[model samples]
Target: MRIAIFTDTFLPQINGVARTIGRLADTLTRNNIPCVVITPETKFQGQRNYELLVSPGLSLPFYPECLLSIPNYTETFQKLNSFKPDLIHVATEFSMGICGLKYASTTGLPIVSSYHTNFPQYLSYYKVEIIAMLAWKYLRWFHNMCLKSYCPSKSTLKLLKQQGIKNLEIWGRGVDTELYNPAKFDFSFRKRFGQNKKLLLYVGRLAPEKDIDILMKSFQMLNKKHRNSHLVIVGDGPLRQKLEQSAPPNVTFTGYLHGDELSRAYASSDIFVFPSTTETYGNVVLEAMSSGLPVVAAFSGGVRENLVNRINGLACSPRNVMDMVTAMERLITDETLRKELSLQARDHAMTKSWDTIFNKLILSYQEIVCLHNKVTA
Candidate 1:
């Protein structure tokens, strides 16, 4: 079936939503499904064959680096409509998504959407407290118009239900087991950071909403007891310089590492600490688990949904440095417990393969398309 996937977030700027969509595009293309990815002109401008539909885009105010694409509705609508996609998927609730919705409305096409971010929760991070309610109102209205909204976890579905969005289904994210495996662990990678120290790793964008300060503080507390443990942070963001300056001596920032380097970083680490409360579903959490490292994440959002709290990994209270430190300490101090959890975590991750998830998503797409076609007939 011909499909068009529209998203505001894409490559050049790295995030879970971008990675997820990119993977889906690749998978769909490989399976002989004609697909087009409609996105903004990215900085890493190399022409690709996937029929990239670029639009005039501008940088966001608070998120200066990330582009907020001003959709060429007339052009995008014409191009996508001509492509004759049996199904359309809007991956973000931005201009591109709105354009996709408008086109779907006009063309009477079957369309689906995915909830990838918690925008309402992000307002307080940007200090836009006054506009948060209005943002929620708009967000709800935007998502409610979709044929069906796909959430990454049941936890997210429940959260959206509380906010009055119906027709939500769980469409979880998956990790590449071959790419992110325990065997990828290089002893030399750990040596480059510091030797004789048990490395505690955290990957993903270093930002306020991530509760990254709590990670640094917790590691500081963890150090007061376990002085030999080192904190290694991967990935960079707006808060990188400030976080680096404020962090304790034991902390090492590796900027941003992707592909093999990122996999090695994950595999090399003894434990993965994710303090982010803002994740709808933490992709790094899955990557860490697939890398065979036990995760210690906040008990908030989708992190709680996957983490079995001591079974797979520890789930501490959100933003609680002491609790996080204590939880990490529990994993660090108990080798047998860590090994058991790591095994369980990897096993769990194996079960949530992209093949399985994508198949289910395709089923949803077919269901929507068939229903829409029948109604029109």
Candidate 2:
């Protein structure tokens, strides 16, 4: 069946949403299912396998990296009408997503949506908590139009349900075990970054919403007692300069790394510490686990959905600096426990495959399309 994905974020952008959509498109194309991705125009000049349609976009004020697409309805309609998709998937609640919703509504196509980000919760970090009520209202209106509103985790599904969004379903994420594996570990990478020191990795955007300050503070506290541990901060964002200026000597910021470099970084690290409580689903957490690195993340949101305390990784109290520091220290000092968790993490990751996840998603799409056809017939 033909599918059309509408999203503000797409490949060439380094966020989780972009990567996930890119992977989904890849899977669809490989399985001989035709799909089209309609997104905002970006500076990227790379080749892609699937059909891509672009709309003029301006950089969002709050998030400069992402664009706010302003599509010409006439042009968009012509392109979508030619593709003739059986289903439309609105991956974001923005202008492009609105275009998808409008097209689906007008053409009587089966439409679905996925809730990826917690924008209302993020308002608190930006000091715009007053608009949170309005944000939720808009989100509810957007998702309520969809036949099925997919959430990345059960926690996220419950959250959307509480926000008055109907037809919520769990659409979990998966990691590529072959790409991010324990076998990718490089001693040279470890030596270059930490030089025999136990490396603690944090891979994601260094933004205020990620609670990076807590990570920095916790790492500082851990470093004071254990001099042999180092914190490697991968990925870059608005807070890079501020974080760099205030960071301790033990912390190393590696801007961003992709492909094998990213895999090596994960596999070589001793522990993965993600302080962010704002994840819809922690993609990096799964990658770290796939690489055999024990995770120490906040026990809230979608993070807690996968991380079991004292199982594959350690779960600490959200936003608690002392609790995070203690967890990091435990992993640092207790070599036996670290090794055991690493094994468990890898074992758990092996069970989650991208092919399996996408196959299930495609099946759901087929079912939705069939039901829509029957009703409209």
Candidate 3:
């Protein structure tokens, strides 16, 4: 089957949405499915996929790393019709996604959308709180037209339902178990960072929307007794410079990491600390679990849904600095408890395979298409 996926961001961009969509395309290609990824052009090089199409874009203001595509609907549909995809999958709410929606509506083709980011909450962080209601109104209208709208986690789906979204389904994210495994643990991480003490790792975009200020304060709350503890923050974003300026001496920022180095970073850390209340689904939490690192995340969104209290990981009250500090201390103080939780965390991650999720998604697409055809006929 041929599939056309539309998104505002794709390869050369390092965010979760881009990375996840790229993985989906790879999965389709390996299975002999012709997948066309519609995205904004970047400094693309190497052997290009004939199926990947690009459009012009402007860099987003706050999120300079991610693009706001200047979509040409006529050109986009022209290329799309030539490809003749079975259905379209829209992955963003930007211009490119709108192009896909318009194309699908005009052609009476089945299309599905996935909710990735909580843009309204993100807007609140940017001091544009007034736009939150309008954003939700637009989101509800955009997604209601889809045959089925997928959310990355059950908790996320629940939130969407509460917000009056319809035709909701779960389409969870996955980690490369082989790539992010406990076997990747290397003492070299300790040697490089001069980490004689326990390492607390935080991975993902360093932005205001991420609730990163809470994470920084939590690290500082790690009392004088735990001064030996080190925090190694991976990934970069708008808040990087500000965070760096406020961070303590024990904190080391690694900018951004990819591939095996990223795997090693997760496996080497004693605990994974993600205080981001904004995540629709905490992909990094799943990766850290796969690497056998116990996660301490906000007890909200998808993170809470996946974590069993003191089982695989700990879920603290969102933005509660004292709760975060206590949770991290428990892991640091009790070596045996940490090891037990780590084992359980790996076990949990093992069950969430990308193959399983992708196959289910394909089945959902077929069902939606069949239903659409019947109704249209």
Candidate 4:
């Protein structure tokens, strides 16, 4: 089936939505299924396998590389009509997604929308708590238009349903075992950070909703206790300066790392600490698990789904600095427990691969098409 994905995030900007859409497009192309990516122009100026329809957009205060596209139904519908896609998959809830929904409604085409970001919970991070109710109302309206809405975790699916979102389903992410393996562990990488120190790593966008300030505070508490430990934060975002200024001397922020460098960073870390509660899936949690690293994440959202609370990794109360520090200290002091969790986490993660997730997505697409055709017939 020919599929068109409309999302605000794409290449030259590293994020989960971008990565997932790119990977799915590659998978579909490899399987002889045509796919098109509808996004704004990126720094890398060139057309990829799927045609890129550039739109008018600009950088925002929160997400820099990400552009907020101006909704142009005329141009979008014109191009989408030519693409002649069997289905349109809206990967984000931004302007591009809204445009796709409008076109699908006009043309009576089936659409599958992915509920990736949790904007309601994210509003508080930007100090816009008063608009929380308004955001939820807008979100409900946007999602209710889709033929089917896909979430990455069951927890998110349940939450969306509770908010009155219809036809919600779970579509989890996968990790590339070959890229994020236990074998990427390099002592040299750790040596560059701090020799003979336990490195606590957090890989994701360093933004407000990520609860980065609390993460820094939790690491500071741990630093006071264990002088031999260090904190390595990967990925960059709008809150980099505030985070860096408030962080302790033990923390090292790597702007961003990809490919082998990202793998090595994950492998060299002794334990992974994630404090964000707004994440829908926490893709880095899976990557950390595949890298054979024991994790300590918040108890809410997808972190609870990814971690088994001491079985695969440690769980701490969300936004609670004390709980996070205690969990970190416990893992640092207990070598046997850490090793056991790491081994189990890796084994569990190795079972879930991109190929498996991609097949499931394809099945969902086929099922949607079959149901639509039956109704039409």
* Whole-model lDDT per candidate: 0.85, 0.91, 0.87, 0.86
The 10 consecutive residues of candidate 3 with the worst lDDT sum are 42-51
TM-score of each: 0.96, 0.98, 0.96, 0.95
Q: What TM-score would candidate 3 get against the native? A: 0.96
The candidate maximizing lDDT is 2
lDDT of 4 by residue, 1-377 (tens): 88988988887678888888878888898888888888876664434567777787887677765678885678877887898988989888878888788778888889989988888887787888899888878888888988888999989998999988998988898899889988998999898877889889999898888988788888877887799898999999888888888887888999999889999999989999999999899989999999999999998897766788888898988899999999999999999999999999999798888898889889999999889888988
Compared with the true structure, the alpha-carbon lDDT of candidate 1 equals: 0.85
lDDT of 4 at 162: 90
Q: Candidate 3's residue-wise lDDT over 254-354, tens digit each?
A: 98998899999999889999998988888899999999999898988878757888999888998999999999999999999999999999999999889
Best-to-worst order by lDDT is 2, 3, 4, 1
- Model 2 per-residue lDDT tens digits across residues 1-377: 89999999887899989989989998898989899999999655666678999988887766765679889889988988999899999999999999999999899898999999998999999999999999999999999999999999988998998889999888889999999999998999888865779999999998899999999999888878999998999999989999999998988999999999999999999999999999999999999999999999999899976798898999999999999999999999999999999999999998988888888899999999889889988
Which ten contiguous residues of candidate 4 have the minimum total lDDT? 40-49
Candidate 2 residue 160 Cα shift, in angstroms, is: 0.5
List where candidate 2 sits over 4 angstroms from the true fold.
43-47
Q: Global lDDT for candidate 3?
A: 0.87
Better of 3 and 4 by TM-score: 3
Choose 2 or 3, whichever is better by lDDT: 2
- 37 in model 3: Cα distance from truth in Å? 1.1
Clashes of 3: 0
For model 2, the run of ten residues with the poorest summed lDDT: 41-50
Worst 10 residues of 1 by lDDT: 42-51
lDDT head-to-head 1 vs 4, winner = 4
Against the correct fold, how does model 1 do in TM-score? 0.96
Off by over 4 Å in 1: 43-49
Cα lDDT tens digits, model 1, 316-341, are: 88889988989889988899999999
